[model samples]
Target: MTARNQGGCDGEHVCRIVDRAGEHFPGSRGKGLTARTQEVLDDLGVVDEVLHFGFRHLPHRRYLDGDQVAEADPHAQRTPTPDRPYDGGLLIPQWRIERILRTRLAEHGVRVELAAGLAEFSQSANGVHAVLDTGERVAARYMVGCDGGRSTVRKALGVRFEGETKEQAMLLGDVELSGLEPDAWYQWTVRGRGFLALCPFRHERSWQLQAVPFSDLGAEGSFPEPSLPYFRRIVDDLAGGNGIRLSKASWLSTYRVNVRMADRFRVGRVLLAGDAAHVHPPAGGLGMNTGIQDAYNLGWKLAMVCSGARQSLLDSYQEERLPVAAWTLGVSAEGLPRVAERFVNGGSTDIADGAPSDGQQLELGYPASSLSVGGDAESGPRAGDRAPDAPCVDSSGTLRRLFDAFRGPHFTLLGFGESCAGPLRDVGTAQRGLVKPVWVGAPGSGADLVDVEGHARTAYGVTGDTLVLVRPDGYLALRAPGASRTAVRDYLDRVGVSRSA
Candidate 1:
């Protein structure tokens, strides 16, 4: 989804996206939305719309051989805090998520060209020439492949797709069915009957069905088309029908446990992102979220390069994101078998038994990247960690979040003492659109932002004045002593943020 259509880049750089698919398919995939994704949506200004339609907590109501057996949650739910307004994975169908994001992109004048996928592309020192599947040759400054695990761009680049696909597979679909409670996730694990679960979608009569039959269903890339009759038969055999009737289906697809990643994220001027770069097992819902993060991480950097930043800044995309993808592959791989074992042989509700509690990837960062530097505190977030959000008070007695200060397509510099005001102001004035500076001090100490409750200090682990520079994507790029505006200016120079040119 990263800048794949006309004017797709985050800012004004002309961008375009081509979806291989003919249209948006209504599929209920990726049941959990982590807080990190929420933060990205927040940064994009679509978090409120996503929250309006998504849910956080729902108990999985389990059954055995046509009898209601138990009810338990899939994972632990956390309450929203000031520092982490989005607490846990949200339950929004992948289709709705796409629509929300698509709408937001459209708001920015992005034009998504559907059914026009990349057939082949060639790049030179300056730009790329892309031949779409539609036989249209388009020229662009750069090219990014966000297609999927079976990415044409990846294949064209001859990049090796590394990893294995498990024999385990599942049937996924959204069907309009009646005769069951629409609120709970109904699961049936019948001996020899196979495992089946029906989860209701929000504000829609259709429920998403996840089923695993005992038979292998002719594995190895061969499977029957997802049909309503096949689903009804499964419901009859495995679920004992339960009087639930499927009127029709909106979307249907089969999922295999594939854990794979590209050997390289970029080749020449053509770049790979999302599933094109990596694909994960269904175990932790890491597939979609990891891809989204890849796009988010690349978006700002790509925009910068497009806007004349150092070309080396583009190198950091893979340098930083490839490791995250590798880590995600490992995590998803470790959790998949446990999840499959439980789904096939039901026991506990924590199907993701060994998955990281940081499911939302809030703790995710690029600590080792060239972009991260200068945080020496042992207890607080170091460079490359997400800049913690804190609620601070303004002079008007208004409450403002650190996120509020961090929003928009700009670097943010926060100085936590009075002494930093002068230099911070100077930088803000010089790099007005690139970096926004906010000074925090006691109410009467005359700072741009006032921290009366010490929330900022608590969240950031600051005992005294400190200077923190956050990148456009909200990761702490640099954290140093408050007086070292020189370090700030140096980093700006390194990243090539032109001073209001």
Candidate 2:
């Protein structure tokens, strides 16, 4: 793979890349990943890698304004239980996440070629041809621009990036700190001044520092360059005394808050994702998570299309993701001013407090996409909703989660209750490798596996005869009542899945 910047998490220009190893940062400004995103990472087989790197299960978030302090609700820390694996969220460092992704890609025999910038590119009916800054030419059937907000690919495509950049800028960096507990995140605000926050990093004596200047300070001709002295001065002004000391600094940069999105995610065969597609403030910590989901939403469709599926499958990428990007932009933009106002007034700046439940991205779906079909309009998880996970027993009597059955890159046919068994079997037989059928029911009900406590049934909101066809990306493609193998096959056929396969 050709990358415009250096390889690994240290790529400066890339939004996903992190410069430090063994350094910890808030996964999402302390809100963490929703159980849904965690499930997706687990499906990709990288969740374990992140855990192996030692993750901090933050118990509480503390906000400090001068002498006043407020603790977040203890219930806010609740995550999904084991039985409902898709329900909770996690907190892990971006660096560790980057390492896990890089490791996984390497295991697949893919290598990143760093500093190979895309200078120019064009596409024809056959494929896209790209020219690198090194005078190299490469061709591919599709291209995705994951570059940051100032993307050359998006610029070259002439996709209008719509939104505005705030007049104020925020400063972020990793620095060495003293006399602070690493267990809880710390935020300090000064009335009519500004705000400063320090969250524990992965390594000892390290913290991720974030500071937003007051309007008066920000309005000054130009922002000062980020340096040790400048950071120390700000810290002294905002978080002085209390035995806090900012000894040294590593990475530092000034960023203007922007809420912009590409008018079109795709121009011909070239597509955009991440900051290249949308840019927004970091209030809800939605930037990185949104980008990751964008790739996840597009990856399987891209694979199917490249493997001879209908070109229309690629169209769903933008259809499904663009709306999501727009929603996220709106959420972050709405939350930005609140957060900024809180900072200036020395009030609660907890982003989670201002963020909506959908900010976790669990509720996001492609309900109106062309790929979704056949489901009850008013009951249960209809087509295009995320497939929830519940506990189940496998054929070997081994206890497993519904996610275990939906783990791989194949469609899953879930037969809820005994009445749909024959149709599920028939669909499984006809689809074979293209789909995996699992019979869900009470234990000893002669089904493939028992829903046992009926968690699966309850979670799926299924009773009597119901069949849910889950797409490879873990979204409901079809949810039909009664036994109808035709319905299953028709839905598969619509998505270009061969029944005979």
Candidate 3:
């Protein structure tokens, strides 16, 4: 991976590899013993490192238009249910997130080469050959371009980036403020002029400032260089002597909003992911989250194919992700105007209210992918939907969550109700290493799990015998009513994993 930034989805990929290896290579632990290496690996065992600084719930959003308050939505104050631990989105700085991921990658003996980049590459029928900027030659079965919007790999593949750049540019910067609460979001909009927003960064004494100047202030159809003085003027104009003052400045930039995506995610053996694949406004905070998800979706599929799954499986990356990117683009675009309108007219701000659920990203799924197969259309989560998490009791009488069972790289076969027992056991025996089977029955029935309070059954939409095969990325691959072993077997075979017996 030729990553310009060593965090975000790149870090996530490294963590996923470590998790998978732990499950599959349990016996190989400490075989090649090195004291230092073991220590690093031990540190990487912190499974929650990915969400180390994440918020328990979304932060409250407050909207202000000049001195007048327009709306305040404390959506993040909602209590989290057992099934849904994260009630809203998390707010963590990108740099810090990258640091945590880098630490994990180091444990796995993967070091990111800073200042190094992909110089050139070519692909044949079998694999891809790449030359790094250091003149190092490397051959691999595949190459992924997670290299931001100005991806060299995507350009080399001649993929068209289809989208338009907004005529108006916005000024963004990080600075210290003399007066402002660090708990809520603040914004000011002058009707038909422009808008200014200041949100508290997670870091102390720092804030993210965004300004869109009114057309009359020479902001429309042109770009302006960002400077400390320029930012101060905008803050003064927007705040109108509200005791808010910019004390010190750190980083600044001028950005033109561009919403575009590659015409194709894959061109032969090279694939596009993250900003290389799509770029849109950060209206719904979708940028980083979407990219991380794109990596998660592609990682397991790539692993499967490299281990003898069909090459055709790679095609589904585009099929499943392209539409999602397009839809996300539309959502963010639609939200921009709504937010601007709220700043201008002082009506109820849909952007603030909708963000809790809209930005949670729990609704994203791959229902139309070739890998998703058979389930009742009218009831329950479809084959392509996200597998909902639920609380349950393990066979050992310990409490566990569905997410715990789905943590590893292998497929999860969930058999709900008593009727599913025989087929579930048979499928478990047949699939062995590739599938981990869990029989969910009533409490005290001696199943692998006892669905106490019927949480699992309710969350899974299973009233009777049902078998759900969840993919490595926590999406349903197949849902067979009546616990049909044939359906499970056929779906597995189609995905290039055969039954052992």
lDDT of each: 0.80, 0.72, 0.68
Tens digit per residue, CA lDDT, model 2, 232-347: 88888777776788887766777777889999988877789888899987766777788788888877776656555677778888989999888888888888778777666666
Candidate 1 has which clashing residue pairs, if any? 4-16, 4-17, 5-16, 5-17, 6-15, 6-16, 7-15, 8-15
Residue 427, candidate 3: alpha-carbon lDDT: 75
Worst 10 residues of 3 by lDDT: 25-34
**Predicted candidate 1 versus true structure: per-residue lDDT over 455-500, tens digit per residue:** 8877887777788898989999988888775878888887666563
Model 3, residue 487: displacement in angstroms? Answer: 2.4
lDDT of 3 by residue, 115-195 (tens): 456788888897777777767777667788888788888999999999988654567777788777776667676566667
Weakest ten-residue segment in model 2 by summed lDDT? 12-21
lDDT: worst 10-residue window of model 1: 1-10
Provide the TM-score for each candidate, comma-separated.
0.94, 0.89, 0.85
Q: What is the C-alpha RMSD of each candidate to the true structure, in Å?
A: 2.4, 5.2, 8.4
> Which portions of model 1 miss their true places by more than 4 Å?
1-12, 74-77, 219-223, 352-354, 498-501
RMSD score of candidate 1 (Å)? 2.4
The reply for model 3, stretches above 4 Å from the true place, is 1-52, 55-65, 74-78, 191-193, 215-220, 345-358, 499-501
